[model samples]
Target: MGVKNRIFKYYFPQKAVDLKQKRRGNCNGIVLMYHEVLEDSIDIPAWTIVKRSNFEWQMKYLRNNFDVVTMDEATKRVCGLSEGQRPFAVVTFDDGYKGNFNNVLPVMNKLSLPFVVYVATKAVSDSSIYWYDKIIGLLDKRDDLFISIEGDDIPIRKSHSNSKRWSLMQKALSKLKSMSASERDIEVKKILDENDARSFSSRIGMLSASDLGAMSKHQLVTIGNHTHGHELLDQISGLEIYNTINKANCLIESWTGIKPKHFAYPNGNYSENVLDALSAFGFSTLVTTKPGIWDGSRSLMEIPRLGIGRFETKSQFKARLAGFL
Candidate 1:
């Protein structure tokens, strides 16, 4: 660990955390956001992939330290319809990664913990990979020194470590996220095909319909909609946002036999129209990528969540839950 982490791990005592929690009382709870959970041996070092061991530690910590609840129960707590222990924690996974089914479900099930998995429907049904993953794969496997997208040629660096490659991918994703979904797909496909990057299998691809079905059946798992195309609702037209969400809900209901009552904004982007569309669709709560505790002061439609994954150390995780980071 680095110097900062050393302090958080060895020096940041529990008494300090207790004081912080006590000072920040009456907050509704905290909702944690995660993406992929993989074994520690996995070579992919993306920010979204939390190693299985680390994930287990975090989940166990939540189970012991906080009242871990499902999305529905969290909503009830948000609305004062039900009561629960203070500093509630809600675990959620986004992008419907197969890791969630293969890795996360077993851990949560073993601990008898509840969580929400938001499925981006098209990826699940079409058996296709997420655009961001494709970008990472293409960049990591590229043989050329540089690649050209549209008319712009971006330099590719020879990296001694995964960190350098990840840096390149982050820059690429920043540009991609600004574009429309179709435009982003076109760019992603160009890079993947030109470099002959293979699509990922069940190891990293989105969950299959059967996977969602099986997971939803677990009493501790709650299936939620994450839009059909995983498009950024704030960037798209109102009609497109409505259609994507509506279509996703139908497909998810078909697979899980349960109509999803909650929705997570893809890329954590939303607008007034997006919120209105979700309300019209009868979604109970909407989760965003905004970081902070859900203190019941925010609208149910604008619920904030702290994104957690590989980048966070155990001490940092403790501090995050305690609202220190």
Candidate 2:
């Protein structure tokens, strides 16, 4: 192992994290972000897809080291209304992937841990695949395809390896992320049409309405709204933002028999208008992809979360949670 890995393995970072929290009066909490948890590796080129074993290990470590609290409790801890261990932690998953219900639930239930899973309501209602997954799936299947962006043809070579595919996908996603919702959708559709590709199942599909309903009934699971179409709120108009969130809120309420109180910005993209739109819709809490310790210093409407990626080592996981990375 490298020097940093060795230090993290020994948990030397925890002391620094603890001291930092201590210096801040021990009021900070950590909210972890995740997307999917697969039963095993299928060599997906995404960082958000954690394997079952790694997820379980991370959960167990959280259970033993930090006070794993609910979103409500974590909010309270942030506001100094509740007391717990220093550096409280909340687990959350975005995109409402089927793996969150299939692979994540059992382990979380076994550990008696509380977590939140945010859903893109339209994807669930229509049983559609996410745009990111669609891209990865299509690219992984062929070596001859090339994607045209901004009058440039980007080649997609399989090379019979994941590294090349991963690099290209990252480039594509970065470009897509910069585009408006309509533009991104049009580009994604074009890629799909040209390739004559359909998103094949490798356990990365969206959760169905039934799955969400069942998960909502569980004690450890709290379902949150991602949006109607999972559009980037910052790039859209305020009216569009309100409509999307409102639509998702109504759908989620219909499915779960309870209105979702929490919302997560799609792709962590948000602006002042986005914040205002969510406020108008009456969401009690909001989460973003921005990484930091959740102390009372920040607004509940723009809470920060540390995402746990798939390829992270145990030591890296520990160091990250301990606030050293």
Candidate 3:
């Protein structure tokens, strides 16, 4: 919920939230978006990752309480192809982290949970550290750091340790969104080049091509497209949107022998233009970062997803699923 909903729910219309929850029938479903599933700590914001144990507990909670479904099942429910007789939920991971194979797949297998992992093809095929992870990886290795954003040189003196650097950079990284895709890439390259930064290994980076094939063969796992380079479609040109989608689609098909019909916009950054482009590419559905229950009221291409992050206890997860988010 946004500020408007919060104010209305608390100060004015106290029953508004309850009424909204009450109206959520069997047709409505919640899509949970996750980024990295790591067993160890990462030098990034905790909100971007969930530890292995926490994710397991979350799976147990969902299995016990909700009708966890696959993306195919979800599409049917949302598109009215299947009888939506009960509240449903879908678990999805944005980036194809190696943990999806090493850590996550085991847990999902143990729980028999159906989930989706949207893979950015380049990361897997080329074994590249995602741009965002590259930035964090480079910064995490240095205690004294200077970043050149635009013409400004911002220096960090106190951000020496891993936690401190992560906390400091979390806020600083958002500013890069203002720059053009080329501009941001150029600046990131400059910083890393001067610092002699090496890209993080795919062993701890993205899912490999083998992982893609493995997940594709799993009965409960569906591989989806993230993009070729994890490009923010709105920040780049329409040509980029066209090219990235096609390239990703092709690569995913080559690896998995099946083209993905669903996609997740990079960083959840998308507009109607992006949606139209995705639709033109024949993508059946796409998800956004916006938090809410999807009840077929919005465009299927712009489905809202609830983001689940680090250290989210079972109770907190239950409440969000219960529509108290």
Top model number, lDDT = 2
lDDT of each: 0.80, 0.82, 0.76
Among residues 3 or more apart in sequence or in different chains, the pairs in candidate 3 whose N, CA or C atoms overlap within 3 Å are: none
List runs of model 3 lying over 4 Å from the truth. Answer: 1-23, 41-45, 138-148, 151-167, 193-204, 311-315
- Cα deviation in Å at residue 320, candidate 3? 2.8
Q: How many residue pairs clash (N, CA or C atoms closer than 3 angstroms) in each of the candidate models, in the order given?
A: 0, 0, 0
Give one digit per residue, the lDDT tens place, for model 3 in 1-325.
3554344333433244345445776677889998778776553434666788888888887776567898777778877778654667899998798888888899999989989898888878887777667666655454466777776766655435544455556655776766777777887888777656754332247888988898899998988899998888887778889999899999999989999988898888998788777777777788888988887677878888988876354545655666665
TM-score of each: 0.90, 0.89, 0.83
Give lDDT for model 2: 0.82
Summarize candidate 2's per-residue lDDT along 189-208 as a digit string, tens digits.
88777776754444468888
RMSD of each: 2.9, 3.1, 4.6
Residue pairs of candidate 1 with colliding backbone atoms: none
lDDT of 3 at 290: 90
